[model samples]
Target: MALPTASLLAPGRVVPPAPLPAAEVARAAAPFGQSTMLPRGAYQDDQVLAWEREHLLDGWVCVGRSTEIAPKGMRAESIGRSGVLLVRDADGALRAFENACRHRGHELLPCGGSSQGTRAIVCPYHAWSYRHDGSMIGAPGFREVPGFDTSLYSLKPVRVEEWHGWVFVDTSGQAPDFGSHIGQLESVVERYDADALVTPVVHEYDVEANWKVIIENYQECYHCPSIHPELCRVSPPDSGDNIELEGNWIGGNMDLRTSAATMSLDGHTEGTVMARLDEVESRTVMYVAVMPNLLISLHPDYIMSHLLTPISPDRTRIRCSWAFPAEVVEREGFDPSYAVDFWDLTNRQDWAACEAVQRGMKTPSYEPGPLAPSEDGVYHFTQLMARAYQGQQA
Candidate 1:
């Protein structure tokens, strides 16, 4: 929920912009040669934002690939969307909840609180705590109260399902099964063998662009040739075309010639695995922006996850994780330099480009440009934005 504007106002005075109320203008409108049914402002509207917060943001979305929390558990949150807590229980079953204490509305995990093998969630505000399963364990001074009911005070639990070692949570408490909602992505992701992978590095940055800008950037390769020189050199330029667009999702493949890159995580680079990329002509990398904010990259040898969290109307935080094979993890000395360096440089280039674009769009002279027939993926993405805001798919 948005904080109130009046809270910062002086008792009897006003600040700048008092002469004019904030105006709503959709930025960078583009015609797809299909229909002009939606406004660009829909991407930035407070009303539409509110609607999304109530509907989609409240609904389940992918959080992290299960590989991040497999042998040991980790913490996750949706931030403004909502706070979600996912932990592997004693029996090792994964559980997700609202990340809160039922009493006094305290956040269960602040500053990423850690749990011993036994200590579960506890409220920092009152010291009340719960079991790993989100069941209320103890709330001192409240149990003896005549009207207090522990049965109704368990921390709120969210719907969670692990698919392809990825953790997904729906906030509306009313989303279709995680696998079904993602369609064929389930099978496609499974082929990657994600569950066996181990994370080597987690890189995150905040970019000065709307969440949509980052999503659109990842959705197409039109800009790849110009913005990312090394990436374009590694992956064939102009090779990315929309292969699938389902509802709010977009996916495509980038063609790249692989190097000997000898050595799998297991140090068994001598086998067919090490030779697969070398033997192949133009290995391909797959990227999908699962609408809203979750963007995932499945490469020939490793996987990267980009999770976008909107900070404001024109800024977003991008969290990325580099994951690889587990055998290499057990080996314990593999440096992330091999895979991490490539993505870090590529993402930096993208951030620089997007920050400039955001500044350009702020000008009054800018207009929604026309989409060439070849740029259908960008067109489709904007179309979904319009549909999501104005058209109810159901």
Candidate 2:
């Protein structure tokens, strides 16, 4: 549950947001035409930013990998307007909580490296120490204060769940079952044995574009023939097809031609063939978009995950990781530069396009344009956004 903002603020200083007029919200959620796009303000408005922080990012969203704060470490991360502390307790279980101190709302830790072997989360402001389980154990001078109760001040928890080693947090604790939300994806990826894949490389990009723009760019291939010459040559533009799925999930497969087995510069498989894939499945590439933050790409030889964190209405930080079979990555002299270079080059190209779109949207005359047949993914994505903002559950 969200904390009471009124109590946290000074007397008579908190101003509640006026409810949006029903007609305006209904218009905002109306389905778009084949040629129409969301209004430009949706990409760069202050109101939209506030709404997203409260409704979208406050729900289950990817923060980082489990290994980053496993066993005995504490890490700080931000999701929308919330500061989160990811902790691995003495019992060896992963947990998450609001980074604010229970007593005075001071940030418990600054952003950066994980603190190793941290036994408790201590607030520098008052030296109030909390065990890994978030129960308050020590509070200097507070023991002498009459009626003070440590039980009433245990750190507030943020609901957390892990999937195949990836960690996600839901600040509102209202998100549906994580497995049920992405079950279709798990069924398809189970064959690849992703749990056995070891991440050997991770890349970060600071994109000057709205988070939705980045996601929309990822869902379509209409620009492939023009912007991604190499990618299209290896996986033809016509090879892209959407996979039918249930719930808020969207995904599809792109066929790599007989001449191309991987997405590298030479279009050849450089790593060991993933076991269990048949001849046809061996050459196919799959893509899945987990709403709000994650974009997953599955290949015959490896897998890539993109986690998008929105910094503002027009800025996003994207972290990309490439994971390969443990056996292959563990091989001596193994180098993933071939696949990394290809994607690194493609990522730059995609970011450039997204940035250009952001610059264009700033024009007062800019308006939504018609979407091509290949942009069906973007259409589906916009629908999801509309529903989310209109107070409909995903």
Specify the highest-TM-score model's number: 2
lDDT of 1 by residue, 107-162 (tens): 77652344545456667799887777778887888768898767777878788888
TM-score of structure candidate 1: 0.81
**What is the lDDT, from 0 to 100, of the residue 36 in candidate 1?**
36
- For model 2 the local lDDT of residue 223 reads 89
Clashes of each: 9, 1
| TM-score: model 2 vs. ground truth | 0.89
Stretches of candidate 2 above 4 Å error?
1-35, 143-147, 278-280
**TM-scores for the candidates:** 0.81, 0.89
Among these predictions, the greatest lDDT belongs to 2
Q: Tens digit of lDDT per residue, candidate 2, span 106-219?
A: 889875446888778899899999999899997999878999989989999998987776788888776666765565667777788776678889999999999989999988
